[model samples]
Target: MVDNPKESAGRCAQVAGWLTAACQAGHTLLSEPEAKAVLQAYGIPIVETRIALTEDEAVQQAEQLGSPVVLKLLSPTITHKSRMGGVRLVLRTAEEVRQAYRAVAEAAERQAGAGQMQGVTVQPMVTLEGYKLIVGSFCDPQFGPVLLFGSGGRLVEVRRDTALALPPLTTTLARRLLERTRIFTALQHGAAGLPAVDLAALERLLVRFSLLIVEQPLIRECDINPVLAAGDHLLALDARIVLHSIDVPEIALPRLAIRPYPSHYLEN
Candidate 1:
């Protein structure tokens, strides 16, 4: 179904306003929930998440999300959550959820003292039966916004398999970008008994992502990592967005690295 123009515009405005407020507050990073919300507003599929202010609330949220939920610490001062042991995944029972909750809360209290950390966020478990992909964008001093697609997850740095392209992308352009990567071949022809990815769906995601970076210039860096590619769909399991205020007029911003896509290209 086609999206209502007014509704779509409203969502965009809300996201823009939130980003502006965050930047004005001198915040460099968006909390995970906030980042996921921004991605959701832009038609990106994300794992639904909710905050729990208390241990009982955490269990309730997890129960509502169903069994095997993941709980992540909600702390502004803590960036390396995994290192700090703030992430607890695959809790299959209410009792497990309670234990995990205390662990993360205690972790936060130790690191930032009392009341420094907000409660935890509960998200449903995502399927592990897919390739882990990364979609990202960053503002280059000379090239303005540049897009990235590659092998993601914890090994992203070690693997270093990636491709770069200038945004505004159409399906064909996105396909070409994918073709430039080594994983594209594996994605087309499944490896190690895994099924082939839903390439069209992934390409559409890339197109929407390109438009996000192109239109939302305030987003200095956006990372959607470990995008699960499976079941004839693509879902972003996690996302992070960093914003910066534009110092100059739109026209005075750095030029594109390559020729721009046609005006009609955006219509499709």
Candidate 2:
């Protein structure tokens, strides 16, 4: 995603523009698409996704992404989509895609109430053969910005295998953080027939994610759950960002070690 330095800088400006408007509007929580845009701007790899408001449009989007697509109800209120039965996966045909779209919309209506359904997101159904890891940041009352890394997916709460690090991480520091996790140990030697996880790639992801937080001080909290890893591939499965209201100039800068989004760069 951050393949070119020039392009990456431009994307950061574009995302900052979006965040600026949202801040002026006094919105805290960003929609999934907004969150993904932030991640993408920072060079974090994410699944190709599109929004569809109708069954036919959903099918069209699915076709564009190719076969075996997934549809999930996209609503700000319905964060835990899987829990609400709002996720439909592995639609092999156009008809299946149409039906899945309807199913997800219906599920959102049933669980989240009628008007809670915003739309549906279509993404390629990724089949990961390696570990799913979590990477995120949240503002600690005492510590300010803090980074999180460890086991993810369905087992996150059950396993509770995570480690904390401060932002602006170096490759060495990121590797050390990885060393503190159980999944890292398992991934080092290869586990259960799966190929050994790409430690370097994971480390880079942690470092880049740290940079995102360092540069974007308005981000109060960000969750990149289930960063799918296989060999050398890493992709963010889902992401969300909570922004603080930048209503006052004094409160604009978070009590963070790193500076806010680079406004000077935007002037270039």
Candidate 3:
């Protein structure tokens, strides 16, 4: 069975401790910035994003990241951005970047009551084709780390097609997980005019993410939605991370170093 009773009990205790602490601190959950920091510390290949406190800073970041950038309002209260127009995409100029920043800020303020928002996140816009994958991790009552993969984004709820796998995943297992998903057929047939995806990279990423969850118990959940697969390159276009309640004793989180995939292993 995928669920282990003993391990699940321990995980539940850990989660309870975290929730108690959150109540004491008056904080609901880990904010995006906090969650992303934890993810970056791990070996996740996230886009280059910088938090900007001012319009000048946003412009500077746009220049640094180059044109056709993305600007978003960083807020803990706002989760679904598309609903509130909190996300701006394909900003090609400094002026456009500034305008997006203002738009996001205003919308966040109106929708969320008090803004309490960080400036903005200036990120490079990545073009994707093959498939948009949503990979996630959740600590289940019976299973320790339940890893999920599916067709991501707005269609996720619409399609409700996904696959689940247990941790310590191998490349072979990852491929099997993908095959179980309905989206895999389309991805293999060049539905978006892109070549077959680099399944090796996808497997590596999922394994790495699973390891991250095992090492960091404080990470309640993580979502790398729309992991774009274009030919041989896989890019994480958007992400959301949630931390467990605070007040749980701070345990040492293991760190994974980023390294290039072994070439010889591919031959086998």
Model number with the top lDDT = 1
Model 2: residues with Cα > 4 Å off, grouped in runs? 1-11, 246-253, 257-268
For 1-268, candidate 3 gives per-residue lDDT tens digits of 1224455445456544654565467565555454454455545577777788888999998998898898878776677777788889999988899899899889988888775676777788875555778998776765555779989876888889899887656667777888899988776766656677766777777766665566555666778887887767776667776665555455532222323243244431
For candidate 1, write residues 48-124 as lDDT tens digits: 98999899999999989898899988876676576678889899999999999999988888877898678888999
Q: Which parts of model 1 are misplaced by more than 4 Å?
A: 1-11, 109-116, 245-268
**Residue pairs of candidate 3 with colliding backbone atoms:** none
What's the TM-score of each model vs. the native? 0.87, 0.88, 0.78
Each model's lDDT comes to: 0.82, 0.81, 0.71
Whole-model alpha-carbon lDDT for candidate 1: 0.82
RMSD of 2: 3.7
Candidate 3 is scored at a TM of 0.78
Least well predicted 10-residue stretch by lDDT in candidate 3: 252-261
Model 2, position 65, has a per-residue lDDT of: 90
Q: In model 2, how large is the Cα lDDT of residue 37?
A: 79
* Shift in Å, residue 265, candidate 1: 8.8
Q: Which scores higher on TM-score, 1 or 3? A: 1
